[model samples]
Target: MNEAAGDGSSFSSKVIGIVFIILLLDLLGFTLILPLLPSILDHYAQAGDVTYQSLQSVVDWFRKAVGIPMEKKYNSVLFGGLIGSLFSLLQFLSSPVTGALSDRHGRRPLLILTTVGLAASYAVWAVSRSFIMFLLFRVIGGICKGNVSLCTAIVADLPCPKARNRGMAMIGVAFSLGFTVGPLMGAYFAVSSKTTGNVFYETPALLALTFSVIDIFVIWMMLPETLPKVIKGSSSHGGDSMDLLSPVSLFHFTAVTRTKEPPSKERMQKLQVLGLVYFCYLFLFSGLEFTLSFLTHQRFKFTSMQQGKMFFFVGVIMALIQGGYARRIKPGQHIRAVYMAIMMLIPAFILIGLSWNIAMLYIGLALYSFAAAIVVPCLSTLVADHGSANQKGTVMGILRSLGALARAFGPVVSSSVYWIAGAQTCFLITSASFVIPLFLLSKAQRSKEE
Candidate 1:
């Protein structure tokens, strides 16, 4: 019996490892296109290009409605912003369904199916020529990668509550590395293509496709059901019965399960506060992230390669802090650390908004990366600590959805602000954007104390 138990533990650990690696690959495949977005949009923004007319048509609509000045920058920001936001929008719409289905069916099948779908999207991306087809690829990829929360749900399902934090940290490590490596390789492939008469322009997509195929194999061979059906869909709240196909269900977690016993007044308030905090924090940061490229390119004349390197450095810092220093944070102590990190971002955004030199930009980005690293895992573990075990998966899924929803809107708003108000104004606004969350956090703290 002892030997059998040990073997079972080993198997579980192996499965967890693959999930971590696959999660890493999923993030990597997505971020691989980050450094290339500006160039790609510019590529199709010309008069004779296939995507130009359709893209410019949208830009013209925005101009008429908002009275924003019209220029090539309008087309560029719209294209990139739309592509980025669409991906997140789909994730917002699909996350809980992915989570709920995994809860009802089993993690193994959902995980495998999502992986296969992602691989298929990459295949389409590799062959894409026109802007419309590439946009189609983005939509397909968004639908495929909406499994972001299922990974968290699995971590929450861990038998040991403490283990969930460690697990989320490990996932964070992978997440950090994915951002670190993806753009670096993307920029390299893009720069290399220039020397080869521009044939390698499609190289980034091909490489992302290759990674997706490999991820599919690893997931197929190794992963087991993280969430078993027996414990999958039981509602602590009454039987709310979520239909993933319903449009209304997309916005509400209640679509997943009804309440048998509604949560306490305190839990409801905490979740509400946390949801607001999560949405606001991600919204500001993602806006900062989405517009950073424009700011750098305009202010410092950065190439795609330089931009990729900057992102790489940020990822390095993030991985180190999340994987190493974050472990030292004890369980109930996460709030203090979260408060500090949230404050750090204010000055960081200011530096990015005002940076006109390489040194200043890198310094600001390093600070930004550190705050992000701390907030992600700490927030996940902190929120996971609340709520009943039976309902934890749904809670985490909802949290991920909130973050995704914020990201969906972040880029569009930030880009428009940047276009209208200038980079400095845009960054300054984002810097002050934390005020809402800070206020919410203080109220939550007082409520907890009371």
Candidate 2:
């Protein structure tokens, strides 16, 4: 809320639009690989790659030890979650470094560096022959996943604090559209080769690589450095910034609501509270998202195509909200929007956990999807409004990096719980997790009043 407003320091609409494209393309590359990687493993296994040799050995041992069959599709789904967790883990480790680097240097150079690296990683993926080679590409891709955080930081830097959510909504629209189309495109390429007995496995990666190349060009040409001259040299700590390496520093919510700065107490507390609440919410939501396919398969026997359709539907709803409704909502109303969305989570979880029919399942999905769509821009607006000018990149990165950390661990833990307990129990526990955020949100309100 302490953001300074002026036209002279504002970013151009063109730069924001380009940032949107960059985020879209980044998600596009990710989604392209996500749905298909498990199936791709079958190819790698058949090829007798040493990595596949090791992985198949583990899979065989697990099946034998547990006396349970891990069918091709089931194995694909489980391995897919593990792979996603790995990517998120890498993103968590790298995001703060990227954000801090952006602060010390500038956003544009970091954006360009990551974008180009991502494109090259995709290129490696396209040409990959062995399972180790594929993992290598994924490792590189994970390291470059800091673009979105940097782009969010870039959006936060624009002149008007209140309008930051609108910019984030535009980025969200790009994300929705990418989510809608990327997997479909990857599927299309994948299906063309799926019937060939593992001969056409590279098609999807090749296409994703192509899109990444375009992203790199766009970043180099149109994206401007949004870091203002005044803020460029603000971070004076030189070699091996100690705070950057400190785990305590990483977990301090939003940089110590404990800071003794007289003028910053309220602002820091708002961010600290919101950041913690949002991180918990994201962790639960991600767990639900990852485990849903298992739930549907058990309850409805849904195929891969059917699951893809479900995600496509969620993406459409998000795109509509972010592009239309979200942009129209006034700044003062963002908190109300966040609260309304949070309330929807209760019924969303209950309906999902208790659903016995397709109608109930989709209805639950719709409610949850709508809630998530609205929350993203609202949270973005809140963080940007409160972030210190010199520390925006670091703050934004830490906020999102924690979410990345949750996403990394959420899937594995959720899936393990689902197996040990059951879908209903898992959903109910996730629903109970909402109590933390609700309590935090109430505290935020009281703090503001005080």
Best by lDDT: 1
The residue-by-residue lDDT of candidate 1 on 300-397, one tens digit each, is 77788988898899899998998778877887677778788999999999998898788898889988998988887777876676555455556676
**Every model: Cα RMSD to truth:** 3.2, 4.0
Instruction: Give Cα-based local distance difference scores for all models.
Output: 0.74, 0.73
Stretch of 10 with least lDDT, candidate 1: 1-10
List runs of model 1 lying over 4 Å from the truth: 1-12, 64-66, 197-200, 233-262, 387-390
Model 2, backbone clash pairs (residues 3+ apart or across chains), number = 0
- Inter-residue clash pairs, candidate 1: 237-258, 237-259, 237-260, 238-258, 238-259, 238-260, 240-258, 242-255
Error of 1 at 278 (Å): 0.7
